[model samples]
Target: MALYFFRISQGRYSGASDQPFEFDSREAAWTEMTAVCSNLLSGISRGLRPNSEWRMEMLDERRKPVFCIRLTADTLD
Candidate 1:
């Protein structure tokens, strides 16, 4: 097993898991990250403001980035 970290940023909100998750492999970590992203996307089902961006970053035990997923929202009048 390996230790993994997850952090997120959206507009003025940003946070990370205080405790790391132990997963069997990187694929498993990716799965968990997607689940988290799904939950966050649900919150924006209503709508998003112009120039809004959401990011989910996965880090290793050494705090090095492993992978990142981004979602951007824009509105034009």
Candidate 2:
């Protein structure tokens, strides 16, 4: 199983750290949050520019940090 990350900022959600909530895959995460995430992305697209090449570090199966998939505009809070 692969790991994926989801996050929201302080003002974005009633949560801590703004850190990621991990999943086994992007599809899995999206499936669990389809309605909410889709709506948020649609709203953000109305204002913010799309980030086609966003990047971030994440841990792999070996527990070593490595550059993973480029984040989509979907990561926006």
Candidate 3:
């Protein structure tokens, strides 16, 4: 297993988890990112959040960005 980090980036705001999650492959981490994006979109549709530029950056144990999933109001349209 390898460690992975999920970092949130929205406009100028940024946050990250100090603890890492162990996953067998990058695909597993990607699956988690997709779920997170889905939840964020749901929150926007439910009027729980303002639709804006949002994304989750997936980083490897070495702190290198592996991929990013981005979302915006246009995504809902």
Candidate 4:
């Protein structure tokens, strides 16, 4: 298993995960990240702080960013 970190950023507000999660592979970690992003988006839709620049960054054990998922509120007709 390997350790991974998730850092959340919403505009000027940012926070880091206090504990790391263990995953067997990067693919697994990516899957988890998607779930997390979905939850956060739900919160926003439910009257949580709406942020146009909300994003989650995935980092490896060495603290290097592997990928980032950005969420934006765009109006569609």
Show how many residue pairs clash in every candidate, following the order shown. 0, 0, 0, 0
Q: Which candidate's TM-score is highest?
A: 1
TM-score of each: 0.81, 0.30, 0.76, 0.80
RMSD of 2: 8.5
For candidate 4, write residues 1-77 as lDDT tens digits.
99999998876888878799999999999999999888778776564354366779998888789889987765555
Superposing all C-alpha atoms, what RMSD in Å does each candidate have to the true structure?
A: 1.9, 8.5, 3.5, 2.8
> Model 2, 64: alpha-carbon shift in Å?
10
Model 3 per-residue lDDT tens digits across residues 1-77: 88998898777789988999888898998898888778777664454345567778989998889989776655355
Candidate 2 matches the true fold with a TM-score of: 0.30
- Descending-lDDT candidate ranking: 1, 4, 3, 2
TM-score (C-alpha, index-matched) for candidate 3: 0.76
List residue ranges in candidate 1 displaced over 4 A: 45-47
- Taken over the whole model, the C-alpha lDDT of each candidate is 0.86, 0.44, 0.80, 0.83
* lDDT leader: 1
Task: Write model 1 residue lDDT over 1-77, tens digit each, in one string.
Answer: 99998988788998877899999999999999888888878777456677888888999999788989988887777
Question: Candidate 2: what lDDT?
Answer: 0.44
How does model 4 fare in lDDT? 0.83
